[model samples]
Target chain A: MIRKGMIILVLVTLMAPCVFAQRVHIDIQAQSFKKFKIAMPAYTGQSDLAASLWSSCAKALRVSGVFDVLDPRGYITTAALAEIAPGTLKDWSLIGADYVVTGAASSSAGNVSMTFQVIDLSTSRKILNAQYTTQQGSAYRAVHAFVDALLESSLGIEPLFKTKIVAIREEEGRKQLYVCWPDGTGGQTIRGGGNLVLNPAWSPDGKKIAFVSYWRNNPDLYLLDVASNKVRLISGLQGINSAPSFDQTGNHIACTLSIDGRPELYLIDLATSGRVRLTDSWATDTSPSLCPGGNDLVFCSSRAGSPQIYHMEFSSKKVRRLTFEGGYNTEPACSPKGGLIAFTHLASDRQFHIALIRTDGSSMRVLPGSGRGDESPTFSPDGRLVAFASFDGDLYVSDLMGVAPVKITEGGGFQEPSWSNVMK
Target chain B: MKIGYRGFVVVLVVSVMFLVTGCAKKAVAPPEVEVTPPVVETPKVTTEMDMAEMVDPEVEARRILDQEMAEFENRDISFEFDKFNLTPEARKILAEKASFLNANPGVNILIEGHCDERGTREYNLALGDRRANSAKDYLVFLGIRPDRISTISYGKERPLDPASNEEAWAKNRRANFVILNK
Candidate 1:
């Protein structure tokens, strides 16, 4: 067995160089004060694949969270570009373009050849170039791959263009839940459109949805059967039930209930309808997240006299406080790998932002500025990103609401985003 | 002066009518009050006959609730800050209550789970369940059948005391017994 493993390792080590060469390259300055601006001219072809490619290159670059794409229509006249190339670069430079993307598409046997080039506008030199063949609808995938390579050449970090988002979509005045691919494809709804729902949570299996719904006329935690479309009330027996989470066991749920008339943490046994209370404070205890081991749970508690996250162990029933630095913290969500806990942290100004703290509660760092009320944050499956719902207005826009999240979903009004676990 | 006199006459007539009727009804109703008092007392006696009904069913419920609340007020379940397990003292109290339940099978008790208002709402709920179940399991082991006892975890919803303190939290993190449906 050791010999076989050695042989496989040897082959893998030998082939690693070739794999690295094929990977996309991203290039950003190690130190730069200004952002990179890129210009994209429409791909030329008569086929639908060409049109898809033309739209995708711009979309991919825009979604990269980098690169301000110069508007061709704003610069070059449509009538002029339709008849003549008109030297599109001249107009782009007049508006201060640092990089340019030029592409041409051709179709044969139902596959498209999307050849694209990245040029450094400053040096007037070609930075990188590539061509790909892909099916019609998936032409965007090819374009994004090329853009990824271009981004690597311009920026040091990789772009999250391919990552997807999970959101609660409001449909026809009712709240429904949905998961959309990064490019907004494969939209699937987790809850029915007509039900009143809040805070949908995804279990590690990625198959079940744990959310608060008024299906029973009062707030109750319901576990939705993703495939069978069946819904069962999980931990609900009077007084303000909400916020359910799953431990590694998958059979039990960690939820908040107000049976005692104040919100607190409770564990529910799926088999026997038994419940156990975990905290006994006169403050609110909510947002329960089970760590990777299934035995330890991290939750937000006002026990410290303010809302903060705390870690609890099952065997010893020992509780240690987790968050101490923040004035107020709530809605704790543990990452899939159990490294970080994402939560909503309130600033001294009463502004809310998504913050990440070490599981040990040592390094509590808030993500760089977002609009006010950036509450209900959750982690992506890979633990690479966090999604939260927030208002776009300045910190003072208490009057303005109902704006959709920046770029995660097509339809707006998403709050309490719970990233789904890895899908099989 | 003429209007005032007319009003005075109306008042005199109303007062006389009320006095006559009141006296006549009082004179005739001694038997009904005599007969009704014992009859009403009998049903109230039955409702209060059971230990669970020691007070007015609703009033008794409120009173029993108030009386049992002293247990939570007096006892404190200590957790580090966010934990759900019972400590040695907590177990000792649970064991004592379990013994009480074992001594009396006729009493049906609800083990109310509680939390110290400190954590996230959902996690505290699971913690509350663990705390309540920890007590329930102890009772079952003490010879109380699981069927005889039903565990209901209230999570962090209910508080024995409204004060937000270590004192209040220690009080809230408890498994309380009440004659719920019994």
Candidate 2:
């Protein structure tokens, strides 16, 4: 992560004309500024694949919340639609673009090649360029790779491209476990789903999903191996065994169990099946989310009279209240980056909204464009975007840029969406 | 005797299914006589006289147990929204359940605590836990063995009403009883 006040200057230069025909190459520096406006025109290519890749790239840039992506309709022109050139730099800058990225895609059969360049409008010189050869219709993978590399190298941040979210889609009492990309593509229902699956939490390795199911007529925590459809019951104690969270090691889970006659937080070791009690409150303690570091857990508790988020440290067993403004704040999801915690807050309007606060319980605010009845806020693997179930029961992903949360999923009744780690 | 009766029922159902399929196939294609080969399996089924001889007291015992268990399950105790404490009416219901449980020895029950859709899924699960176990505690106090009763909270995932209205929500927040065999 970049320091809040630091600055980075990104530099890019073009390769020779012949080499640029098939592939673009240039140098790059780090970038620290926010909201750098960039104009991207349709890449020069004849295939429909090129058009699809362009739209995918444009949406990715906008969703990153790092760039003010200029509206393509504003940049549409007779010549701009046909081809991209260095001569178009003036047109992009005239539209108040501080930077411009242009590309060309050509594909036949199984192979597709994409050549792209990023230019700094102030210098009127190309600052970065690259090329990729990939399977047709998956040129977006190259774009994702580029964005991942660009963010890591330039901003010290992880990109959220091509990530998958697993959520339970329920209709007419049949709940099927659904997994899809952030853009609603490549969706497939995971096997071994039951009629009552809730609260999916991804393992750090992205290879497993821990969720609650009632296959045995009890709400027990179950771990599902993504590669194989095999499932193993992680916890089946009496009463409720829900809200499973994998610690950083993936060998332990922090969950809620009521075996002691009331709901309390418990840590179950995956290896020994041993358990450790974490909370001793008389009130119900649930929705435990392990921080990225695994030392702290943010969970919703009724210890303070109503549902509120609490932060607990394992070493000292110290507990502190996190949310005081809302009487119905719950379902806390600690970010992967370990700085912020996202949770559902019942606003004064009686609508549940997704809100974020620092780990210390400061700077609490509802996320912009958060819908009513929003619950189960899960962060992207990179901590850049948040995927949550909206009021209408569709999965929505937003970058917190004040843009309305885009519905990345179509099916209704998506509940407790758990985002997998960036696809390995 | 139970095994023989169940076997007879299975064979009877399978033969009926075969007859139905055979007739459908004949209607679809009269020339395909090979499709009606179920005639060979028809003789394997036992006559009604063999079934009449297999009847035993165990079958009547099971029927009575099932009816009594259904009544036990149908006697669901309700709670106020977001609250799990037993009320006067709920306590009266539980007192009657305690007698039934005392009379039926060797029978175990599972108490499922549920919530309405008005609350979030995870928190309601915890609430449901308290709701179900609260009933279990009272039963244990009323002289029922703790080992005879188990509890599970379905939270808001399983709803009795499945509606967004208050009446449905009221019907949903209750502790339901399920019979389990030893």
Quote each prediction's TM-score: 0.52, 0.79
Question: Which candidate number has the best lDDT?
Answer: 2
Q: Give the winner by DockQ.
A: 2
**Model 1 lDDT tens row, A49-107:** 55666766676565454566787776553321211233555766777888767777777
Name the regions of candidate 2 deviating beyond 4 angstroms: A1-34, A76-83, A137-139, A149-156, A171-173, A401-403, A422-424, B1-69
lDDT of 1 by residue, B34-129 (tens): 344444544344433566535557876667755554553355444545565567887787676666566556667666677875543345554665
Error of 1 at A294 (Å): 3.4
Q: Which 10 residues in a row give candidate 2 chain B its minimum summed lDDT?
A: B32-41
DockQ of each: 0.09, 0.53
lDDT of 2 by residue, B1-182 (tens): 99999999999999999999998887875454545444454565654577666778998888887887888999899999778899999999999889989989888999989898876889998998899988999999999999999888888877888778889998999999988873
* Candidate 1 overall lDDT versus native: 0.63
Shift of residue B35 alpha carbon in model 1, Å: 74
Docking class of 1: incorrect
